[model samples]
Target: MTNLNPLVIAEIGKMANELIVTYGKYKETKEIEQTERIRIRATLLALTKKIEAETQTFQLFLEKRFEERHRLYDMAEDLMKHGMKEKDPDLINSAITLIKFTYCEDPLKGNSLLKITDTY
Candidate 1:
């Protein structure tokens, strides 16, 4: 997955706010040159396109992450069921370890547990 930069998102938000203020100022001005009006309109259109694209990217990232989490949960459950049916202690232990790894908060700790589970 591509890494999402929070700073970039924040910068876009700041730029949007500035554009909104500029637009409001333009609306309040009594007399504005035709070229200046065109420029402002063009800028607003470009910004709107950029914001829409970024929103879609963020939404897709969220959806993918959600799907991955669900997939992991389902795998763990399947492992647990198979282990119980086979009357195998090792498989049951592996399933419990995977579940613990999934719920682990610390990334480093979780990674280690995941490595262990992956071996099974």
Candidate 2:
């Protein structure tokens, strides 16, 4: 068997202690990282729920607003009929324009069938 001097034995012990300290530090960092990930995931989930609630509220508002606009369109239609009877072409054209602007299926207005369904 090879002889080991006191200095060599001491050095080996020091290196082993250093490795243990390094491993402890690594474990602590991993635990902290895991905790942070959990917190971030919980925060994201809460935000998603809040967004969904807001989206539902906006959907209801859009429905009510659309109903009101539809009523206004019916009134405009009645006005247009009266104007036609009175031989006022300008009044008829104005009502037609209003209806078009209010009810037109516009891509820019996000009025696509799929978009409306997916949004809610």
Best by lDDT: 2
For model 1, the superposed segments whose C-alpha errors exceed 4 Å read 1-32, 105-120
Per-residue CA lDDT of model 1 for 16-37, tens digit only, reads 9999999888876735666688
lDDT at position 102, candidate 1: 74
lDDT of 2 by residue, 7-119 (tens): 99999999999999999999999999999999999988987997798678768767876777878799789879988998899989888887887777442344332353333
In angstroms, how far off is 94's CA in candidate 2? Answer: 10
Clashes of 2: 0
- State TM-scores per candidate: 0.50, 0.66
What's the TM for model 2? 0.66
Q: For model 1, which pairs clash?
A: none
Best-matching candidate per TM-score? 2
Error of 1 at 113 (Å): 28
Model 2 lDDT, full chain set: 0.80
